[model samples]
Target: MKKQHSRPNILVVNDDGITAPGIKNLIEAVKELGNVVVVAPDGPQSGMGHAITIGKPMRFNKVDLYEGVEMYKCSGTPVDCVKLAVNKIFKGKKPDLCVSGINHGLNNSINVIYSGTMSAAVEGAIEGIPSIGFSLDDYAEEADFSHCLKYVKSIAQQVLDNGLPQATLLNVNFPKGNGIKGIKICRQANAKWAEEFDERQDPYGRPYYWLTGVFQNNDKGEDTDVWALDHGYVSVVPVQFDLTAHHAIPLLNSWTFND
Candidate 1:
């Protein structure tokens, strides 16, 4: 059992900007669990999967938004926020836990690969901190996150009590509204976004394209995150930053490569 400090240092971050309602609710959920320090984008950085700022400087500013909460808004991607929190804010002294998001939309299945919310959690995992990313299925500006406060707090508390496996982080997605069945520990379903670029002319007569897609899931596993979410269960998929396909190594070993 992992014994957290009486006042654990919990770093809270999100891709939905500092002012988003999602982040506010997220802070409320876990603020009592420890010392909550927030560092997030100044504006929405959704879908910016694991991206980091390069070739340019970013602006970071401190603000007093939520009373009694230490928060900052960064002019960078979600991953950059975690990087800044781990390196600058925490001053290399790792936080006891890192929680990202209460994202405006779901990030289950293949969506995790392209989610700034989950990417922020992934960055925390990379920094050797226990992390989890939370999201809701709704995209409305006024989406209510009240129904999830209990579950969020419980999950964070559990993580505080029991640390996650090495290098593993959680990708948690909740369905919109009340009547949540329960929590389901599951795997990421084999899924993808069938994307296309819709082209149109701007007011200045310049052609631009908008990226859009339909989520495709063919995996029939009942234990997958998609199935859990579709059934009103909060899906918790343990994810890792290691992209190694160790199982394929043996198959590739049979093939000889010319040096």
Candidate 2:
């Protein structure tokens, strides 16, 4: 970690391409906090969870956007951006922080499973770096991000000051309205999408399907990230990359498999 007085190196990334306004606002919010380096996808990579380029080669190009900030656009997924940022840009030197998103839409609850924004942060956590992913409840292209700035700065500063737990990163979501409550540290809500596919015939007489779904929040707990965002509060959920079902180990150990 850099000294308290020294500016720390921060790696900024996103699922929405580098030019997305959400990322621009994020840069504006956290730029003064550290020396910012941006590495993001060249195009939207939403719903691409933890995907990396393997079959084909991946490439990146330096961009002149975001004046005074070193930015690069990568032809890969959000996870790929993080990998390239660490291996190519930083040259194996892990940054002080890795922040992804200020995403175009909410990444609360079940959305985290498919969110490229959160995946970038997850990649950072895998690399043993303190990371965060921010999102707003609104999905509009021109969603107002005015209320999110202060919270972003606060959370980023806090993470910089007191690092996150081992192998964990944060998934933060902001409410849409202007009547903002306070920030809340909460758990991931038990929720999922009830999906359906709409089939239609095209002009060429071919059928295509569009996936759609309704979010179902079955968890009634008020301490969950979903509840926090629903009640006009900014929700912060600590996410872990470990997929071990440790709780089931004891039950499995009691089972007899000898035939």
Candidate 3:
């Protein structure tokens, strides 16, 4: 059994800015488990993925958002928020755990590849912190989070009690309704975004393209994240940052190299 710290230092981050209700509820869920420190984006950064702010200066300011919680708003991307928290705020002392999101919308299946919420958790895992990103399927600004609180607390506590494997983080997505069946540990669905660009004229008469896409899930496996989410169950997918295709190495070695 993993030993528990009396009060773990928990780093909380998100992509939906500091004032979003999603982050507020997330902080409330995990605050009792540790000393909560929030370092989040100042504005919405939903589809930023793993982007960091470069070619420009980044800034942070202390805020009085959540009472008794140390909070800061960063003028950068979600990943930048994590970097700043580790280097500037924590001063190289790694937090016991990191939790991202309670995001306003879903981050399951291929959506995880484009989600800033999950990217922050990925950054935390890369920094050797046990991390999890939570998201709800609802996209409304006033979506209710009450249904997800218990599960969020349980999952966070579980991670605190049992550290995750190296370079791995969890992408957890909750169904929008209150009648959620339960949690399901599942693999990422074989999915892609069917994309198209909508071209329209700007006010200045210049053509502007708006990117839009439909989520396409081709995997028929019942053990996939998408299936779990669709069946009123919360999906928890163990995500790894290592993008290497290790199985392809042996096939590549069989090719002849011309000198």
Candidate 4:
């Protein structure tokens, strides 16, 4: 018997399409948690970042994939999907929390800048809802997320139970396979991608370049997300939307541009 007076309605989403195995597994895992409503893209939108459809018309339709779960597929970016859900779809009802992704690849280090997974969660944060983004460091379509579900549910429940700081959300990454030991709450690591372009000739004889890179982690701190991930644990990074360099404000006031 399920006890339910209102178990906190949870709005689940992801950058991956509705049918992705990652989300399929996620929905099953969260069924015991609360009312799960999924609003996601109709297809993969991996590197879409935080983009939204403004100049173009967006479309969303109810989906029948998950039997008792409310699911919808949108024709816009991940951010657009959240906007539609909050403004139009679930208008009068507010979700207790929003969780994005069991993404195909890692969103650690600097990859969050280009992650559609994090963007959806960030959009929820912007709307004053507690949110979280979860990703695994594997890119295969059938990647094993067996090692991630327990940690995902634990983190989600923690966020739901304790709540989060206003204007902040979590960006979580799990190591691939079953070797993961546990979870670690850490800060974002200072790292970047060292790019390399591979030039190739297209079928029409036109030259193009494929962008590739080696991830360079310059931070050696044990408390960083990168360090935690490398140590075989799920890294929970508290992410905030405030990009202001507050410490630099005082230094900027002392600058002399007239000289």
Candidate 5:
């Protein structure tokens, strides 16, 4: 751990490229809270879950997109941006905080498995940093983020003041519009995507496919993130990177081995 500074060093990252409106709003929400440094993908990289660039040279360039902000565009995945920020920019000193997204679309429930926004936050947790990922329900480029800024600042301030539990970060999702009820601490909903691939032929008669899917939420519990978002409350779920199924481990231990 590095020496604590009077003003915390905050690292901001996202999957929606470096120029998206979501990131700008996120920067705005936290700019006054700390010294912010942004490192994000050069273009939209949504659904890129915890992906990293390997066996290829990745590009990193500093650009002055936001006035008075230190921003860099990376030609790699969102996870790569975090790695680069920690390795090259911070020089092995982890930031006081790491926040990902203000994503244009929701990353609740099963969507977190495929979200680059959440993955970036997960990467921060893996590095032993207190991190959080933020997302809005709307997917439009011009989605209004005014309602989210206040909650963003409040939650971020809380995280900064009181560090998160071990091996955990937050996955926060907000409902669209100005009628937010409140924030709720919730669990990830039981949900998944029912997928279909539309096949078509190219000009040369070669086959191609377009992935499409409908999000299906089977969990009906009111204590879930899905329920919170549906009812106009911002959902904050504590997320951890450990994939081990501890419950199953005990059952497996009880099985007889006759090999």
Candidate 6:
């Protein structure tokens, strides 16, 4: 049997409210690995990337959902839940690992920038904690996660034993249902959205618009997350917070600013 502190203390979070089945499944998987805590949004917060509730007061309440796990529901963005967990809830205690998601949909390729699931994991990395985000390609409320729990536990166990690199975390995505064959460490694919807006009218006849898009992937690389998912493998991409274009710095230095 592993001793108390010998096993990691884990903080679990997600964008899809505390009540979502995705988080519930995640909580069960992590419990077998270590002590777990959950702090998540009170309602669905999809697409709220890295957003904090600075403009308004944030609130959270404890709930008894998962047995043997301490859980809280917060009225803030996914990032805010991490902030609250580290700063207020845990205070001086820092968790060994932070895991987000088992999100209802895919967060691969360019979707990371707009993903609240990834944002929660990003927040943990910002606070100097080892973090990881997990998502499934399925978007339905009843999406099957039976195939993901084994991989989730294995990956979480490995991260707990061997910590992640500084300033970097993992972005993991799984294909929906029981089709997953194995895990693949992959790079982020070059992809973007072919956007469209659906115009519609309300009961009052005022027009409103709903944003939609199809993904366009130009890169044909087989070592990318996109390719891995398409091949029925779970994709794990190591992500960094620094967005500096190191290659472009030299080009800017050659420009003459003196007029």
Candidate lDDT (C-alpha), each: 0.94, 0.93, 0.94, 0.88, 0.94, 0.92
Give the alpha carbon lDDT tens digit for every residue of 39-95 in model 4.
999999888999999898987999898689899999999999888889877795778
- Candidate 6 at 223: error in angstroms? 1.0
Clashing pairs in 2: none
List candidate 2 segments past 4 Å from native: 1-3
40-95: candidate 5 lDDT, tens digit per residue: 99999999999999989999999999889999999999999999999989998888
Better of 4 and 5 by lDDT: 5
In candidate 6, which residue pairs clash? none
Per-prediction RMSD in angstroms?
A: 1.1, 1.3, 1.1, 2.9, 1.7, 2.2
Q: Kindly report which residue pairs in candidate 5 clash with one another.
A: none
What is the C-alpha lDDT profile of model 2 across 142-177, one tens digit per residue? 999999999999999999998888999999999996
Question: What TM-score would candidate 1 get against the native?
Answer: 0.97
Off by over 4 Å in 4: 1-5
**Backbone atom clashes (below 3 Å) for every candidate:** 0, 0, 0, 0, 0, 0
Model 5: how far residue 8 lies from native, Å: 0.5
**Candidate 1 C-alpha lDDT tens digits along 82-147:** 999988899999998999889999999989988999999999999999999999999987999999
Better of 3 and 6 by TM-score: 3
Question: Among these predicted structures, which one has the highest lDDT?
Answer: 5
Lowest lDDT block of 10, candidate 2: 1-10
Model 4: what TM-score?
A: 0.94
What shift in Å separates residue 96 of candidate 1 from its native position after superposition?
A: 0.7
Candidate 3: count the clashes.
0
**Per-residue C-alpha lDDT of model 6 across residues 1-259, encoded as one tens digit per residue:** 1223576789999999898899998998889888899999999999999899888898889999866789999999999999999988779688888999989999999999999999999989999888999999988889888889999999988788778888999999999878678999999999999999999999999999999999999989999999999999999999999999999999999999977
